[model samples]
Target: MIGGIVGIDQDIVKADVTPQVDTANTDISTNYIATSNDYGKIGGENGSDWTIDSNGVLRIQSGTWNDESVAKFWSSLKSDDGSNINAGNKITSVIFEGNIITGNSLASLFDSLENLKSVTVALGAKFDTSKTEDFQNMFSNDSSLESIDMHMFNWENVTSSLSMFYQTGLKSVDMTNINAPKLSDASSMFYNCKSLKSAKFDGTNFSKDGVKLPQFLASCSDLADVSLQNSFTGKITDTSLMFDGDINLEDLDVSSMNLSSDTKTSFMFQTSNNVQDIRRKSITLPADPNITNSKIDEYNTDRYKGWSSNLSGDIVPSLETYYSNNANVGKTTWTLVEKDKSQYKVNYIDQDGNLIETKNESGIIGNPINTTKILGYSDPKNSESQPDLMSIADNNDQEFNIVLKKLAPYKVKIDVEYGDGHPSESFSVDIPYGLTSSSAQVDQSILDKLASNDSLDLDKSKAFIQRIASGNPATEGDGFSLSTVISGFNIDGSDFKSIFNGTIDFVNEQVDSAILEGASGQTFDAFEIYFDKYEQSESHNNGGSTVSKEITDINQKSATFGDKETKLYNSNGVLIPNIQLAKNSDWKNDKQMILDGTKYYRVSTDAWVKASDVYVYTDNISKIRVHADNRSRIIRPNGDLSDRALEKSTEWKTDRYTTINGEKYYRVSTEGFVKASEVSEYK
Candidate 1:
């Protein structure tokens, strides 16, 4: 009467029954009990030992069981109280701890155990059957066993699995870790396991050749999932009635099965009508001449039924064309048969082969590719003809390329600047391709200023821009401008016209300051205008010494050297040798000349200076009176004072003036000049 909790528990003694020992057991150092009311012996004499607790838990501790029918031994067991006991009903669980349980077979090991529910191989121990070759009926007829932890089982040497879990109450079985490379039989392995909902064998190794699998999962009416992914690597000899009554299976993937020419596949999927999807690597029908197309049709119509078929590998005779030759033969209607479409991507690239955008597409073999136009871009080669079809016959990802060039013009920024830190006027214009200014609407004021300076060569500056726009090499300083200058641009180093399309700041360094005009904020400058006029001097006979009185020109300009010392130039606008002017020096000039777009003032008969380097004032002085000291000594051309002097309090007519040591000297006589300190204006 084994009515209690069904697991391992300590046997609390209400009473004790003496253990009986056989006379054949000679080892007195250990208590080798043959039978008892509290426990029973599992291992034979000279083998290992076991015990059954009051909770009906059989604990086999550190031992081996001789290869024999363990179920039959349990049916005929007797207790040490000299009474017959039903071990099957009393044993509810078996716990193996610390040892080897080897045998030639595991057939009927736990068969028909009406109350057996669990078998646990403890951690740090294994149920080793390394020498066994059979697993027939291993857990057969165990209608109460819902699960088994066989993770620690060593089944490397097994060769058969016939009816292994037949008619069991297994809800799920994960034999993913099983490795039986020599196994050849799994017939009826889980046959009639009506409660099995899932059986996973993802990593199991069943590599034996010509393996038999007839009725493997037949009659499993509740079977919903059976995963055998990549578990088969052999030629199957038989698959008849493999899933005969598995009406709940929705999808079956036998893609790994290798059906040889001599294989038997009769009723392989009999009554599995719920399955809608079937996948296989390819179809390899038997090579026997007697097995005709009619035979295969019968199998599909009466046994293996599938709603859709997904097959891989190339078909020598297409599935539809093969049946076309045999119009009399009836074939199953495969509602959907297809191969996965190959995926590819089209990359839109710039002229320099830089990727801009990508489009992903998919199609079957020989399908033409279509493309769309991108704004502001066009293919230079006009090679935008329809691209080649999807030539790759397999379902692999690939890529293609289409190069495009920009069609829109570059927006260049035009800036008018003054070198004297004045606010710059900026605007943007659409410069055409090739970096040309043909489409540019330059400010008329800027162009007018550029032409106003006779020293500025407008043709040369326009030519410089033309060189860059025509794809010729050009540098920033190569071009000149009176009102606007281009800076920070390099044509050779830029890729894809990037530098040309960016900001092009036109800076006018010539105009240091400007005045706003007409309230439009657009200013213009007329920097130092030059004229072609000449001056004359008259000689007056003073004491018969040919005293040439310098005649004043009403248009004469009074020029003063800038704060910074500057060099004097010849009349031809060339720098005078060793003629540097002191700062704040003053000179009177009536003539001007234009050179390199800059105006120059003629300080002497043969010397000139840039107008930009000095400040000019209107000269209206015509006569001067000598100081009362009367000692107005005359200065020689070599800068020495002469013995001659002007009469005291006498007025004289003068016109020319010169700078000496930054002092003003006026011409009182043609022979020498008088210091400005000794002269006063004659009103």
Candidate 2:
């Protein structure tokens, strides 16, 4: 009776159950919220340190506002039962007045402050979550907490995290400075986080040592532009209905995933189907031939009986720029060609179009290129669970097509894998039907010209193939018929010792996404573009057969944690705790970072002021509240505490700074003084 479609012609009905109000309700107020001790902090040793004024502003009068429970500050007139008053819940805001929270898991300490709407951690305070794990129910069902700035909290070793933020009203979360190497169970961790708008989880957040992640962010329906590959790099054995209800996830990349142990993935993507494109052809089995995972077949049968997996291994490389930049998407290629008599080398180009050296081709060559070395080989099928990278043909069409498969959003990716173990025969191009080309260049140039013309007429495409097949004339007098020229390949694969394969990626509007057709009337995402760079199949011997050593390569960003240093390098790039190393003598020269713009640098690695000793003045005013109740005192210009004590109402004005015995002090006025650690810095 509570949920259904609210049609345009329907008038919505509501239940009018009114709640009772108190006769003497002070809730209707123009005053602010102050120290209520609403959380039963009364009769304690430091009891009178905090108090609220008539204007409702809760202010800390003295002492560190340190506490184990933040909710103790909340209370309303209705819950003040003879000093049993509740704290934090009734108060909409609180002033820290300067308190250093040395407690753990401040995420959970605010568990009782469900009504707390805003909190500001003043300077000189630090919150640590270095060893916290169970943030479950930490902010569970806290509907009133709209924002919690966690930029300053440290989360170094958080582990078990079940329902950490179940049903909270957070609009955004700051997951900065987090390190959860031992994280295991995170089921429903952000379950149904309906209001979570954006997230900033980096690669380290999902490293190894964590357990399987299932239903972790299951129903985070409002999330978009998320990279599942970026947020979770741990094992995922059971992904059953993991994202069954996420209705707004736009793109997902699960490429090169290790599903060797994944036995059950039923309904994992049942309802998360409204996507633009899947990133990669997810591996069912790995590339290894020795191992086979049988569970994948059962999962496929049980999970995809009705719904389609939109995941695939077939690719369509774009040839639209075949005449221009030779921009191919899959694994990139490096070839070697000859400019007339000069053997000009062909450099490899990355996916980003940057020219990279041939494998082991740069720097000093320790040894000569070994022709006896068998670099690598390729096959139609590598593993039972993995996709067939060479499944490009549709019902055995002999002639290579100009047209591509019409899978929108998903373009073809040719995986230009590095390292050898591939047969060059697995990657050869078919000579056009009528062309008897002794020259690989003439044969390839003709093909590239036709492929670049997207709207090439079908009959003309057929004629070109037939002309090359039966030996139609481009003219025999042409000079392309040499014994061997450039072999069509721009860069030779043997130099880099690379392999070739294909993958699936989104239709990149940034590079090329043009679709073309072949002589068989079938269309594809790409035509045989890069293959034309190779010589006619009779040049170089690949696998005992005369095939050019044409190849491709794509740079894969290695997933392993590459950085081992965890020390925080501050503005000056100086490593703290190594302060003694900064002792400069007449022998050591000091380096200076250019004082341009707003750059920060460390003058001496050994120099640093204590946090308690540092304070900044605002608008020419550096005043502090008098919290010394009965022990108020004055100090002389000579930096000595006066024998005569001052009244409690006197305010101290800070003027300048000085270091006495390595301890910093600020002059509140001409002769006034207060230890920096004893009073809060006024903003």
Candidate 3:
């Protein structure tokens, strides 16, 4: 066995015998029989060099060999010798390649290879398992075999798989490689492969008569992932304990299974407590499954959602069907607010996850734009209408409009001189439309900016600017306070002249909250207004004037009307535009007087006046009116203070006069006299 004599492992007295290993592989090795079906005796106690050590691993040359030779090599392990070789106990791994297996059944080929950790079936290696039905103990008790790549091994016509892979040390196995088209009886096929984690079998293999899978993977605690739909579609009926002990299975999606006609599914998932979801919640039932001795009652939740059958024995959906049935029950509500041009309009939830119909860009009220409020959807832009002018007018979309439509209903009010704890500074109140208050009480609609903790409406934040500018009523809820959202839409120092201060900042603020979807009518509380003062332009007490002054203070001859009524006298000694009053001969000299408890002033002998009703001026003339009973107070148009009654019967003419709060008086010639309502040209 030295170098001088060719080594026992390499002795080749004959010529080279090379053959094709597979379609594309040629046997170039000098030792292996290069042809298939050589059937030479392989491993045994005899002269055959093939031998599995006490460790049970067949140590062969690391190269491709003929399948027939490999088969013979394996068969020798179970040869009819008076002494049984340690075939089952010692052969742990096989490293051989061949295709001659097409002539034989590999039923117990590697069954007892208890320590066999892995097997690499060579290319073109086909097992003629078509005619043979039994595959009992195929790789049984191979505890050390971690995996076997049988992709090249075909089992197209195999029918049975009892104890096929029982007690193996495999990690994951895809039995789809073994195309068992006629496989029906698969009981205990993978029983107790404790180390097995996943088992994926081909569905086509079980297309034949259904395969009974009772206790097939029983007690395989670590086998969490399983896939065997072939049995459901085939003629295999009895599946009593298919996954009887798969305790840690997380989810099982069986929606693809068509178990339309099965006889028994009792205890299919018996004691497998941890298995959670079994989808396609229902399994088919036979027209008449004999469950007299079965545990069908235990098949309710531990396995499928529910297993039920009436007189017709058809399986019905389980309670999990609720999800598959109710699709719209949880629809969310929200508005898709886009800048419609110059203003903002809220496209509220109108239909399935979409906004209501809206007038198109055309004033003609074109097809309503169904706004999308879907989570993953982006609203279409003006891009929908190609080549159309980006113009808002060319488009009825009113953001481009000088006047807003949707936000027009809302408002903001600016009440000046807000004197709280501060130094009586002026502030603005940005309230919703229809909100009323006192002060300048200007009582008029004013566009004011808000600055406070008011939230930007969740969905309406997108275009809150337009909403505020147009005074859209936040009537729905306590609308968003423009203050908090705006921060500063244009408050110069303290002047709130514009809502464009934090234009970009505010838009960023609403971008997130505004687009968030909501429940059907969810609303925000009132937008508590906040204010930024513009250097306190003007301040005072409770929005009132800081200083009080009358016109008389500026001009000695002019004064605001006082509280009392007054009278005047005419130099002509006759009362014109006559009215009834307490007449007396008052000679004159007094420009102010008091009658009873009120103050008064006399402009002429025929004219008497209430202090508050008279606006004094050096030469100012106001048209007088005869309201109710006009007392006797006559006067010449010039300037007079007398107690003579005005002659209402005399037809006096006036050249010019002024009206106050609608009441009018006239100057007649060089004398004063009649109420415009009661004289010529007065009306």
Candidate 4:
């Protein structure tokens, strides 16, 4: 079937006589075989007879059918008027009935039948195939025929079944009972049976000596399952191209078959690498050591054949050595690939061994690593520089730490303005990078640096630094300056660096003068650092108690001082230096306390004075009159005086009041407080 041979002998003579049959009914089954006169075959035995019934069933009844007689059976069919008809195309079914014996060559018995659909041995039939030797093209190329039931067939003497069912439309085959002990060649037995889905030959033995099975099931494209059990027990000589193109065959086990010493297994699995499991039980190499060693060398070097043998046991020591040297004897070679870059992480660990940050990147081997600088991190030794990249090890678990050090605060020059008309001086103070909030106090080291400078004559005891509030300091008071005197010299350089160009204000006070009084009705600004000269030493009396009580009733009321510039005193009745209240100036008072046999009231955050210097009111005043020309000043929340002053003889509206050193102060703005001694109610 593979080479398109029709398998008919060319020497057969043609027949001239036609059998008598009805012309109207042209179906081949409705006609019968020719009589003695009508038959014209020139060779073979005459015992076999062919007949067709109305159902298109062709029966070979009780006779011996040889190759030539069977070929003549094709020419014996006729119509009613003795016209030749194609029995191969018209016959729908074939049955071997009664006692029958086939000759040595039963090849091409029903080959190339166009419409033939079925073939079967009838019940109670004694069909014999013990004498048949060549079944080369039997039943080959019958495209429309789907199946056959030949369970009674005994293939005990079949020598060569080459192309027996080639190119047929068979869906499956069961040759388990068809044992061919003498069968040697089965090349192309089921080749190109494209529609065949499965086959079973598990019982059929192919153990005969020197068995040749080339192209046994090659090119069965649709074949999926093939079962074999005791079929391959004998010594196999030639198995080249045995399963050449059975692409859909997934598993094949020829492990039971012991290959002869001179077996030709070249390309046995050619173009069939998809068969995942192939078991070779025990393979015996050639008896000659040179040939066996040469074949072993070829197996090791053969690149054209992609199959790998699963040879479990080797009869020769050379093959055993080869199998032992290569554990994956049939597997492909190893391939190299690049490593993944995402898995290598560079951890930035601090000096305390804490993981501060991490970076994921892979560097090329033997090349300098590319790195970036973190904002506030650096090498421990250098605040301005980062760690060298080459120093970090290149490994997945490598801890790449440069001993991450926090960057030192950089120095920024700020202009210090002394509100006492001194020339503003510039000093450098540290401002850390990426600072979040305002610092509570300037670093003491910065103050020490300023104190050591020879250009500025600042009293280290009185000198303090802080940020200013507005662009015009005289109107808006100080910036967060209450945190300085109430706490320490605080710095909020965030907005000040851009808005005020790093400018700070410093005011000098006359702390040595005693009773520094203002003119009559002269309103004064609340003092910043009210007791700049007093250190609150242990020598000062506490009047039997250290803690002061809250005077909630008259806490925010106004107090009118005496006509003379009222003198202020401390909690111990000691006269305070450089501070006094103007005569008749209305002041707001807060807390009142008795100390050292004298009653004093606190008018600011730190300042307190004798209660006799002012007359405290029961109710808070809404307006205050400025009596001093330019002495009236606005004080910060921390009791520091700002540069602003109230106009003389001007009446200012007051929202609320608080007491500082027994002198009441009224709130004229957000944080500016004017002392009651500097202002009185305008009438």
Judging by lDDT against the true structure, name the best candidate.
1
User: What lDDT tens digits, residue by residue, belong to model 1 across residues 1-683?
Assistant: 11111222221211112112222332222322233323445545434466556667665656666766554455466676877677666778766655656667767777777778877665555567787778888778878888765454556777888888889888777777466777889899889988887787766666466678889888888776777766665667787788777766645555445544466767775654443322121223221211222122212221222224323233222333444443433222233223334567778888777888796655444445545444345532354433553253454467778776655533333343333344544444443222212212222223323223233222222223432332222334344332232234432211111222222222111111111001111121211212122122334454555543232222346444333667788744567887777765667776655544456767778787776676543333455767553457777433667788777668676655555433567665443667777677532
lDDT against the true structure, each candidate: 0.52, 0.34, 0.40, 0.50
For each candidate, what TM-score against the reference? Answer: 0.38, 0.32, 0.33, 0.37
In model 1, which runs have C-alpha deviations exceeding 4 angstroms?
A: 1-40, 79-84, 272-683
TM-score, predicted candidate 3 vs. hidden true structure: 0.33
Worst 10 residues of 1 by lDDT: 510-519
How high is the lDDT of residue 319 in model 1? 38
For residues 1-683, write the lDDT of model 4, one tens digit per residue.
Answer: 01211122221111121112222343444455333234532225545565655566776666765555354255345777887777666667777665688877776777777667877666666678888887777777877766665455557787877787788887777666456788888878877877776777666675467578777777776665677656666667777776666655545545444444466766565544443322111223222211122222212111112222334322233443454455433321111122222124556666677877676544434333445444345533342224343432445564444555555543434445443454544555543322222122233333322322223312211212221111121333333333233233333321222112122222112111111111112222222221112112124326665643322213334444333576776644567788876654556665555443355677665567666656443333345667532347777434667788777667666655655533457766645667775576521
- In TM-score terms, candidate 2 sits at 0.32
User: What are the RMSDs of all candidates, in order?
Assistant: 41.9, 32.2, 39.1, 43.1
Q: Where does model 3 exceed 4 Å of error? A: 1-81, 102-104, 123-132, 202-204, 228-231, 272-683
Report how far off residue 130 is in candidate 2 (Å): 2.8
Backbone collision tally, model 3: 100
Task: Sort the predicted structures by TM-score, highest score first.
Answer: 1, 4, 3, 2
- Give candidate 2 regions above 4 Å deviation: 1-99, 102-108, 112-119, 144-150, 173-177, 228-230, 235-241, 255-267, 272-683
| Candidate 2 lDDT, 503-559, residue by residue in tens | 011111111212211121222222212221323211344457543221112121111
